[model samples]
Target: MTWLPLLAAGPALAATTSRPWGVLCVGLLAAVLGAVLGIRDGVPGHELAIVLSALVAVTLASGLASALRVRRERVLAAVRSVAEAAQHALLKPVPATVGPFQVAVRYSAADAEARIGGDLYALVPTPYGVRLIVGDVRGKGLPAVGTAALVLGVFREAAYDEPDLLDVVGRIERSLARNLGPDDFVTAVVAGYPGAGRMEVVNCGHAPPLMVRDSHVMAVAPTHPTPPLGLRALTGETPSLQTLPFTDGDQLLLYTDGVTEARNHEREFYPLAERVARHMSDEPSRTLAALHDELLAYVGGRLHDDAALLLLRKPAAVGSAPAAESRASVGEPTRPSLLQ
Candidate 1:
């Protein structure tokens, strides 16, 4: 029947990714085929012309649908481009080394399609020393992204201007309290190297960072508990800075819940400490690369939430210049606390 050809053309054109004209041509050919079949079946000349005319109409409709699909795809591409640019500006990439530390960073937004999300990480060399931060917002999508951006912007500015690490955290807390929703909060670990062999960390309701020294791994849990950034009012307690010995060949790993909370098919959370102990190395970059690969495999190649990992190592030669200075042309890939 003439209707059968129209039905077939509709689906074929709907699935085609080629130019609309190509699909239009296919629809036309189908219509002509139907007409040839009608003539062979001895249909009247006037009726055969009507059948061909109907096919032409079907072809035109198919072309219009194809055009709409292409237009939508172009619009989405433009949107993605804008999102990527925003990500670059907000999450400025870290150099391989800063001051006395060798560093590496690996970040993955749970939505692979999006270039940025709620997870945030940063590292900057300041007059005080090198400061860094890694944090995660409470929710997902655009609102979460906005909060993460705000936290990072304040952290960067305060890290440079305020000599006190606690002051840096105070600035972020004030900003979030002013701008964030009542229920919004961010869990973060802010740390800095005030001197060549000393490091200070302030934990804000975040996962405890892992310390690796001489092939051993241990959690750097703070002795005092502190609320996440936006809820400091509820607890009425400020975060305390924990100082540690960060000598040559020692590394510190800072991560969000995404790293430890990722589940496998069995619904078991990945054992980050045990795994890091197995893959620990003097090189921060190589260690993180291995960890990220294993994490993806554990989650079946897709993450459900934004993930961020930052590794900072005190080189054996502490006073010497960072290796990255010579490789400044190469891109390498933060925390608040003033440990004076």
Candidate 2:
């Protein structure tokens, strides 16, 4: 779908901020100008009466409205500051230029800032190509956030030092085992981009990454899969790394259970594959927007848990060849937008 519907509300939302004063002043000027123009069509006494009444209304309305808006603005300003701080801590930032492809990210927590939980995504450039992780923590509040931070910290370091993707998974498991209780566990998908137009993926009880090429999506998962990260010790099994074919203009999307498990008013699960087929083009920025919008629509506005998505685009040509592909534009690390 086009983004027109989302753009329509931009002005309305801007109306609630300090910036709104500029718009309000412009509107008042327009009203005065219209009245002056109308005076040409009316008698002196009538025009004066109308102008006087309009002035009183404008003064009283602007005064009371300004006071109320100031209070609301103060609250929102504080909220935005805290949300931005938390967002930076939880999902730092990644470069748009990773090897060959451009990377862009959009993350949304169900609650404004202190309230968001359950979902997380991060991409860090490691010595072993660009390593990425996308997964959901099990619960909410500082506890869930702690679990998520635990996973990401282990993944980033392991991705650089460990040569094998599966080994990286093991490292994460050991870290969690030490930090989390025996019952606590996290489902995750960890992948290594070797920058050779190929990907090595290990699924630790997480959803498969959606592969896109030429605007088509191909499901990519290894024939052999492993249990979730924490459960490896419980199951006495280690996960295997899965390799899949990839080409330039192709992208791999790793998302949390939140996206697939999301339900609607009819209680039907969100159609992940179907929507991907429609929006999975050569452009990841657009693809992400479509997926994010579809997700919001499915849940009817607000999400109930933390949700995350990480997208990787493979270059059209690897090694010795230079071919430009789609890009994920990185924005200034401001508070993550509510739109996502």
Candidate 3:
């Protein structure tokens, strides 16, 4: 009779990983066992009834809890599906090749369940050239995501309409100034390859991009520091365009602070440039993949913040003829050479 109370644990444990029906089955089995045990011990009928009634109450409660849990899980799954769809629309996937450069991107949200976060990146082949932007919002969650979407939307439009690279940055700046709150801001690196063996970069208080030249990794620090987006009005300083030689076999890596700020058990930040030098490869995708794997392992299998990595490599020319220029939009079929 004393053991009859232990039967409640059967349904309680089942509620955690089984369906309501499974919990019901477990409860019914426990009740039957309790009855057998009570009779074998020659327990009083009233005492037996009391124990059985408590067991029944616990089982019913466990079944209801299981039902509610299953329903909540289904709702969460639907929410995640919608978030994924929104992410695809906001951060359209880039092809392996954009214009003359081989491009690769890797992004991870701090919230594993959210699947998308404040970190944002976009690479598109515009009439100006292959232009790309990598930026990190000031915060996380829904507000950060909305700010990132605003920046990308302005960038995609400005990259094509504006002839000058700085003008593209200007467009994003003005848009953010009008929309973002005084406390909100974004740090970004906007870069473009305009077909003159030169890569134009406009840094807005973001991490210095790593340039790989002749097997050497060097940080492309901005000559003139400027405030981040949405704070230009306060600082009254505009972003300056920095042009660098981007010849054949050269590569550039742009990433958010999350990569640099990631810490291990010892609280040591990830060495991005050093890792990039070690993982250098002819293919940008393979190189980023190796770096990303090492990064995750270095941080003990997870990053605490949203991290984004964009690597662009200019392949050595095969012939005098330039690669065919192409453009890709979301949901559109990519050209054979541009397929990722």
Using lDDT as the measure, which candidate wins? 3
Instruction: Quote the positional error of residue 235 for candidate 2 in Å.
Output: 0.9
* Candidate 2 residue lDDT tens string, 113-147: 56446677778777778788888777777788888
Give the alpha carbon lDDT tens digit for every residue of 42-133 in model 1: 87788777767766776777677788888999999998999889989988888888987889999999987788999999999999999999
Q: What are the lDDT scores of the predictions, listed in order?
A: 0.83, 0.68, 0.89
Q: Candidate 3 residues 147-178, lDDT tens each?
A: 99999999999999999999999999999989
If ranked by TM-score, best first, what sequence of candidates would result? 3, 1, 2
- Model 3: residues >4 Å from true position, as ranges? 319-340
Name the top TM-score candidate: 3
lDDT of 3: 0.89
CA deviation > 4 Å runs, candidate 1? 1-7, 40-51, 318-340
For model 2, where is the 10-residue window of minimal lDDT?
330-339
Clashes of each: 11, 3, 0
Give the Å shift of residue 239 in candidate 3. 1.3
lDDT value, candidate 2, whole model: 0.68
